[model samples]
Target chain A: MIPKLNIVPFVSVDNMMKLVLSIGVERFLTELAEVVEEDFRRWESFDKTPRLAAHSPEGVIELMPTSDGTAYGFKYVNGHPKNSRTGRQTVAAFGVLADVGNGYPVLLTEMTILTALRTAATSAVAAKHLAPRGARTMAIIGNGAQAEFQALAFKSLLGIDKLRLYDIDASASQKCRRNLAGFGLDVTICGSVEEAVQGAEIVTTVTADKQYATILTDNLVGSGIHINAVGGDCPGKTELHADILRRADIFVEYPPQTRIEGEIQQLAPDHPVTELWQVITGQIPGRRDPRQITLFDSVGFATEDFSALRYVHSKVTGTAFFEELDMVADPDEPRDLFGMLLRAAA
Target chain B: MIPKLNIVPFVSVDNMMKLVLSIGVERFLTELAEVVEEDFRRWESFDKTPRLAAHSPEGVIELMPTSDGTAYGFKYVNGHPKNSRTGRQTVAAFGVLADVGNGYPVLLTEMTILTALRTAATSAVAAKHLAPRGARTMAIIGNGAQAEFQALAFKSLLGIDKLRLYDIDASASQKCRRNLAGFGLDVTICGSVEEAVQGAEIVTTVTADKQYATILTDNLVGSGIHINAVGGDCPGKTELHADILRRADIFVEYPPQTRIEGEIQQLAPDHPVTELWQVITGQIPGRRDPRQITLFDSVGFATEDFSALRYVHSKVTGTAFFEELDMVADPDEPRDLFGMLLRAAA
Candidate 1:
């Protein structure tokens, strides 16, 4: 039987800006967070794999794909540190959502912004389950492009009332403060990583140096502080030092990947760490004491993207993302893939 | 400085059909063949990997990604023999080509149809180099979805004027006959595999069963015949009998992948086979002698998809796909991804 020409919905970056504006960013974040939570709850249903990364001299490009029985999704993302000098973001991405039942792509969306939103939302999910109750203060070190999202997610989800932000580039810190000004949180511009980490209920390090920068040293990390380690997410690129990882109880999205890409990469191959899902599911201990330091090595995983794509697809339904794309050959005759094209020409 | 939101081109199945049709199927094949040949010549420039495949109980899903510094492309494809029974095609795919400089997808297109086109185009390109001069009669064993394309490609590229076709399903053979009738080829409906193989200059086995289907035994293959084996692309899915592969001078797309996914999976890991790229570049021998049995153990590769994506992208330049997607967030301030949404809400 000839499958009718498939119509894939296309979401351009311009329209994406319009859609996010129409949806209201707060409501979008809330909905995205819920989707993240829901998908994480049923994690085993997905056909998961560690993303395929091709490292070059400049940066890296990766393809992340996952599928449940019904639908498949994948994101193509690249990270080039030098891109900023060329007016490009360090990370740019696009993704596809397809019907696994038919193997036809149904939705194609620009994922550069979606990835940022999802990454922040993911950290919030981890922090909510692992952090101390009524956490009110967060120190956001490495206040680059992702800092504001991390700050807002903590504010929206974890009840963070104040942000102690720090960055070597003081302009980035200034930008972070300016961006989060009216986002319903008190902000403090800090002088150093140590100052940022001092007495805060949570510490978030999202520094983007493509090296072992050691943005968070061991001595600064204290008890009862939940550290959302976001930036050290590639092989040879790290933020937390080996001692800090050893001292703090570490949680990861996926062990196989975290071993290579997370802060724990500095630790032993047999380093004891808990999977965040286990903590979320209450299958493992999160924090034994209020004074215990919890470090979530947030390298990200394909499952999170699966969750994010599922969330976006659901929200986009009937929301006018259905710009019909001629992605599949819906021929009058199935065997005539050639004939279909020939007729189209005629 | 915030980069401009990426405008990814969307090529739907319909657009692809229209594009292929407008370009003319023969010209498209000829163009695509040239694309493959040209890329094959610069094989060393690509960051190539034998596609990352996830095998399951039902079938397999694979991500074939390749980049050449400037542009990166990947194809998401699946093979499930049981899918047809469930009202799905046995194979379905879609792909994206992106600017590595910006990490934004430049083109997103459904590859279900494109896959068939590229496979046929690739096989024909191989045949153009390896098939004996003035070869007319081709035996197409196990005529399935790809059978007609194989027929037309050989006819167009290698001047094969007569088709000796056989399928386990008589309806499949009839489909092949009906599809190719407009092409003006001398088509012969053979009853058995042996009958189809007899006296043919080139033999292409494009079967669909996910088993060790012995479509061609050694005894049936005549001296100086070219065997284009296309169906035995995944583990446990093979076409040629062990004796046939053992005797034939095997040619493959990529040896590493062919060892696992092609008919060569039946042979030893150390078994000798020439990569078609080598033959294309004249770095290795294709057919040792005119009387030798030559086999192109074609397990599709990412490089082939790279060639196809490039060809399609160039043809559809300046064409407007759709301007309604709201997927990328661009704000006056790059740091204000959240504020951009907030401003939109206001």
Candidate 2:
């Protein structure tokens, strides 16, 4: 027997989609949403900290690493909006899943497309618990790369039927409408953000600008609107107006991180915000009144990545998505790493 | 041209060894040593912060991420010394190199073997500045997987001929000795750490115990010795006793990280160890007298990874180590990320 050397399972982007779709995306999304909620509810088990960032003039590259007692994972992602002009993604990512016991990577995957998928999955999961009862219409402002995911996730998880979309570039909204054509969601391309938010039960601000732009003003937001602020992730990148944040009952992933990264950055340091885990664990009220303007400031936490990785890991098992390349060598002699390399060379 | 979207080069462990050997291990070590010195001298230009570590009961997993305003890199590494008992390497790692300007990953490589190579290269570079002039007869306590690299780096950088090796596991010493058989260095396997360090000019402790089991006591110390404390990285993991550390004038790779994760963690917060950059830049004195003791308290900083990644990136330029998979899409329209996936599905 050749021994179980090079055990880190790897899934390329194409293989990942193949694996996800083989199990059916809707069922995978459902399971992922459930697991995300499960982990978010018990967030205390995670070793939580702010994402370590290395800021450059052009953009910021961040590492979001988290570990429970059993498994450890980290994502290497960068946000460069200007990159799209150069025929590249505004964001590209890859991550590693390691066993906590031996601290070796068990899995590695390309996270460029997975990030958008997981981000929307997390938003939909949060919306299931935080959105107003029987919410059907979702207003998706800043209709861009994340817009389609949000639309599909909302439709898949929360039974959202209608999407009112708006972006500064009208073509972006058109793209969103075209992408969701087969997804069976009634998407309306709005001329303005206010028009997009009109009569929408849930408003998702998933923009790409790396600035504190007011995508949702106070005048546009009405009562009973569940605002999923996903764009305001970095320190200076914000979307919702400070007034809109102040008026709504806010919920966050991690309070310490959300205070600097989420839409709540606009509010005072002491501005009361409930952690989403408290709501999930039934320790705090979630959408107590149907008419309450509730906001889930979804900055895309590490636990979401954890849930997505685990969900994908479970779904992709017994599938041919992994390519077992020679990565970490399990040496013939435990102490002789050099001898293995020498044999490999020979 | 089809327009290559994401071209992050990858070097696996097998290819990495071939790369090191192809580049001539001696020349690779020397070049990487020079790169480390160059990067360290411009310390303030980097995003200098301590690593974000996720500790487990067995070992610790860490993300040592850093950027120098232009290029960014981070190594995902683990230290589970007991893993060898289960037929796994005590350390395994991989890292990414990204363009900080665009936040796009330009390179990703397995750093398990690269780490040991770079760590040894860094220790040798520090020893170049801190060790006494024309020193030979180096004592390497705990001759494990990394001992060969340490021996070679010293041989290449300083022309050191004599090696006094000692390891509790006799097999480990045999492994190290076998790896360096024809590498043109006289190796003598000693019985104990004291015998190995008896009359050596430079002492390097590269043991792999997780706890503060002092491998070098005050009795083992000699005059004019430069101790490269390579193991004892992470809190509560120390190789040298407090008295030995107190007697030796220590230098470290980032004080914040070294204080928390290096041998200096055993010392008080203000227990004065000079940053290696100061010595390299001539701002601080190293080896004041020939009789004075010097110690390079190496906890393996991010800057070294940055330099190593840069070196690997240069060496692997036209080599066939990279696979340009469809990780990030280059659709006709940037907003049609989903459409591209749909088309690929079709």
Candidate 3:
């Protein structure tokens, strides 16, 4: 079909998978990481706000919106931990990218897979700055849906060739290992969190409980190791112990939001933390010393989603991975919308 | 094709026009007015918030969100008055309705046509309680895209048969007069706003300027006339003179929002105004006397959009007015999202 002004390109779940597999997931993550870093370098131009969330007894739904003056983007995402038990994905998402000039959407895409890729890309980008030099081994606790993506992103971006996976459910760890078997990674399924973190240079904790459970205690964390904390994203959901948070130099994306939703929520309200953008722009030092522990509080921000959507929009330009959706109303004479309807009747 | 678990029903602009024309615009407005009134009766059960707006030099884009404990709905809309000159709709919108329990969107729809229908339906519902008894003649100022819808709604719900229309641009008024010719309404194109309001029991100011333009001055508004102010919907954008507002008992959709966006912005911060919901629920009288000038300062509320989306969701069930959209990802095993990608490669 010929594209029209009222038509927005839509990336469905099936087409999104085709896009990822066609581009190759590792190459996509590596390229997306470069885009994420580019946006972080110019982060001051963005209009930022904390994600608007509506909490419920079962789960929470959120709208994350941001604009860079020319383009506006927002993601509609939900996190329901109990959904997995009922044959549903624990997290599901979709997003829209629109023109700020005319307020018409240009692209709409399923973001469940896009979000997974962006989160892992963001983690790898932060690790590129904060992880110890020549880091080779990485341990990921809570090997659920996001585990393989994180492992692949590290392998592509930082040359991390060894993976130590651990989960409370052994099948989850086995699934992670099986998924990574052909990816040239030395994968190991550890029986305990202690065994998972034993000689690893980086530790990623991404559990899926909506409570104040301490997946990483202070005793489990050692100096000179970088920690990626991904699951402590809402008000009452946290994954790290307060002792580990107090000891580590916490790096966050948008402190106003991370203060309420990230690992720093366990710290004092006035506790000092450095923004990751400053580190990306070289305004602040990333890893001060080899013995210092760096923790990236990854609650996921709007700009990261904006960067991912922007990347997808560019890649889908000449590709058939998206279908045109007749979304906005376009009247020949703007003031004659009623006349347009009347003509449609005829 | 059978609907999958992740498929969401999408109503496009073409489908929306078909649905509206299928239902007959007058009957649709009357039924939607009933739904709007029913939702207003239980206003306290909703989680309401002022729209999250991103303002720029061009115009503004906003996300208006609300939830009724069981369902959540939001509209993404834009207002750029200059867009009409470039052959674009000055106001364009779309919305989504989701299940609050799992935070999954059940419907996605083009809401530009839906917004016009809902705004007209809401005004008629409010005027049903506020306008004088046996009101027949209505005047519409600024005959733009919404004018025809407003005219038909009053005709269907309030027994209005005579319309005196005025616009700064004469061609717009002529277009409005032409659109309503076959709708069984006696329509006249007036030369000025004063002539339009002459001998009219209800006057609606629906101009589209983004600045403070007084379409209705103090002398233009007479006693026993209900003023439906529809165009002064943003900060620094209003349609009435302060003198006219001072002499009128203003009613608003939501006080906090209307105080910033409605004509009431010209009034004092503590200016007393009644909530329209209270009047609809009979907690307060709508019009105390025939000589009282009742002003409905409508900036449009999220709950109105929520009610409109709910109404559309009900009307489109099992109808050909919608298509199934594969927007959400559903993995067979929720934790094996990455494995699902791997299998897709096969």
TM-score of each: 0.92, 0.97, 0.99
Predicted candidate 1: what Cα RMSD to the true structure?
3.1
Estimate every model's Cα lDDT from 0 to 1: 0.80, 0.83, 0.93
Task: Compute the lDDT for candidate 1.
Answer: 0.80
- Write the residue-wise lDDT of candidate 3 on B136-177 in tens digits: 999999999999999999999999999999999999999998
Could you say which candidate leads in TM-score? 3
> Model 2 segments beyond 4 Å from truth?
A1-3, B1-3
Off by over 4 Å in 1: A1-5, A14-24, B1-5, B56-58, B82-88, B181-184, B318-328
Model 2: share of true interface contacts reproduced? 0.65
lDDT by residue for model 3 over A207-257, one digit each (tens)? Answer: 999999899989999999999999899998999999998888989999999
Predicted candidate 1 versus true structure: per-residue lDDT over B248-292, tens digit per residue: 888888888889999989999999888888989999867667898
User: What order do you get sorting by DockQ, best first?
Assistant: 3, 2, 1
DockQ of 3: 0.84
Model 3: colliding residue pairs: none
